[model samples]
Target: MIRMMTAAALAATFPLAAAAQVAPTATVAEGTLLDVVAEGRVNRVPDIAVIRAGVVSQGATAAEALSANARQMASVLTALKGAGIADRDIQTATISLSPQYRYAENQPPVITGYQASNSVSVKFRDIARSGTILDTLVKQGANQIDGPSLTIDAVDSAMDEARVDAVKRARERAALYARALGMRVDRILMVSEGSDGGAPGPVPQMMVRAEAKDSTQIAPGEQQVSANVRVRFLLK
Candidate 1:
């Protein structure tokens, strides 16, 4: 969203905080200025994929459940490594062991069994084969799967492009306003930028059969990087 900070009069209808910081006053003979808040957006295709894959096991005893979970989780990790996933790109996300209980109508709940779960978060630099890798992890005893948040690894360049666009747009807006008022843009008084944008969060996963007929399909759409800037220009 973009906004125009014209004068104290413009602030009469806007929030006090925003109005208070409206176009700053400058000591000049003309005493005319325009402040514009502009946003710049740049879109780039995502180059990486992140996912969470895990194993859950159950047994009559805690030791049994833990051992079973460990064995299955080991296979899952090995599968990721076999698919060229580096150790640095993989990290443990969760690990838990809890006793299962049976609810009885007439008495206290009884302990039935134990459950063990272990999960890992993984980053795939190769988005093309992410789906196939996901399926392979499932076959390797990963029963719980989540995410595939697509993102760009290095965002500085994209952000820089966006910032440039914002400044350009702000200048254009100021010029338009000056033309309408029969005045000309004289000089830039200030240029300030806002904070960075948010990254995509984790997405839910649908359960698929471990034994699939073919390699899974993955589609990584474009991601957007945005920047915001506030500019104050002197008008003559």
Candidate 2:
């Protein structure tokens, strides 16, 4: 009989499995999900300046090219030291020696000469004198200059301030939503945090010639730091 088979199947199952199916579920009116976005901004003053600059030289032989590059890099390092840069703050970024080539329509490329390059990274504490230091580098033999990325030396306090702003904004938004629905905020259910590291703006490329008369004029403008937060609260 159908009833007999059903009873037999039930008897074969474990007691825990049968109990799990009959367990009581929480009883409450289902609530709707409301997503809110809150943004906080903080204006930070930069404390350190990082710059990349280098020397380029050409010679008939690889050794000669490297020797020339070394001499020019030495002079550049000396200029940085004179400008109050410490050895720990200055580092050689790259060094390379390669043969230059001349190409023809039907003939194989011919080695015309050898070129050597040595690049260095410099960090400066005094940002106001950055332009003058760049001028000094060019005068001493730096042919390529990459960037002067401005950044804050420490971010703990700034980040904390930003977090406070974000939380305040989130609370304001939640209150507005609750009031619209004819209710008051009861308790915060959850909070989620997000962050972004600000990227530096564009830097233009320039070729400095030894015969140039004026120092390179640089303008380091203000940078923006942004934060976002999400908060969930119960409605009373």
Q: Pick the candidate with the highest lDDT.
A: 1
- Runs in model 2 deviating more than 4 A are 1-35, 202-207
lDDT of 1 by residue, 67-96 (tens): 999999999999999999999999999999
TM of each candidate vs. truth:
0.86, 0.79
Which candidate gets the maximum TM-score versus the true structure? 1
Per candidate, the number of residue pairs that clash is 0, 0
Rate residue 29 of model 1 by lDDT: 47
Candidate 1: worst-modelled 10 consecutive residues by lDDT: 11-20
Q: Residue 149 in candidate 2 has what lDDT?
A: 76
> lDDT, candidate 1, residue 131?
88
